[model samples]
Each structure stands twice: as structure tokens, then as C-alpha cells.
Target: MYVCICNAVKEKDFRGAARRCSGGDAEQVYATMGKVPQCGQCLEDAEDILFEERQLCTRLPAANACQGLRGLAPA
Candidate 1:
């Protein structure tokens, strides 16, 4: 999906940028990817995606830990 319409950035692109950027910071992600926020409306969504991506990264290695847990599913 399109994350940043102003920069034509996709979610995958944002994920990659988020990994490269520090602490999952949305602003740093944009600067690291050489993209700048224009309309500014996308920032909230972008930050959300970044947070989700970062959270996923931290949990991925231990994914099996929650395999049988209840209510830990994605929304």
C-alpha cells in the first residue's frame, strides 16, 4: 500500500527505510530514504506503520513464543 503519497513510497519501501533509520523514528526514516514529507497528512499513518514494523522486528525472532497465546493476533 502507499504510505507516503507525496513521495510515492510503498509500505515495503518504508519498512526498509525504517530498518535503516534509528529507533523506528518516522522522520528519520524519511530522511534516510531521501524522501521528504510534503502534505504532512501521511505522517500519522507512516508513524503507525513504522511502529508496527519495528514491533514486528523485535518479536519476529521469538515468534514461536507467542504461537499458542490467545489474543495476540494481528488486528
Candidate 2:
């Protein structure tokens, strides 16, 4: 579940950062965590995670939005 091994960022941490990220941008997510992609290997996966998190954020009901997107499988 490590998304950015360079920064030791796990998927759960990435999802939390992604929710707080305004643009759902991979770079921004990294920045939010005070890290950056070093080897560039995890960029794609990071972007995918950010995208999926953003999608769930928009699809969920307002009251429950961004509470935590657990249980839902990626589309």
C-alpha cells in the first residue's frame, strides 16, 4: 500500500492528503505531504489514487463527503 516509497507515503496517507488537496493534483498531493516524487516510479499510481479519491469525493453525499472513502472499490 506504499504509494510513494521515496517518501514512505502509504495509500491511506495519500488518500487523506488527496481529500485535503484542492485540485486533486498528484504534485499537489506530494506537496501537501511535504515530499516529492524522487524516482518518478510512483507518479502514475499516485495520480490514479488521487483521481479515484477525487471521484469518490464528488460522488458521495455532502454530509458524508470526504469523511473516508472506505469499502468502495475503484471503478
lDDT (10s digit) by residue, model 2, range 6-38: 899999999888776656368877997899889
Off by over 4 Å in 2: 61-75
Per-residue lDDT of 1-75 in model 1, one digit per residue for the tens? Answer: 998898999988887776555453577679888888999988989888776765675667455432222223222
Error of 2 at 73 (Å): 20
Residue pairs with clashing backbones, model 2: none
Which regions of candidate 1 fall more than 4 Å away from where they truly are?
61-75
Report the poorest 10 consecutive residues by lDDT, candidate 2: 66-75
Total backbone clashes of candidate 1, pairs 3 or more residues apart or in separate chains: 0
Question: Candidate 1 overall Cα lDDT vs. reference?
Answer: 0.69
Question: Candidate 1 — which pairs collide?
Answer: none
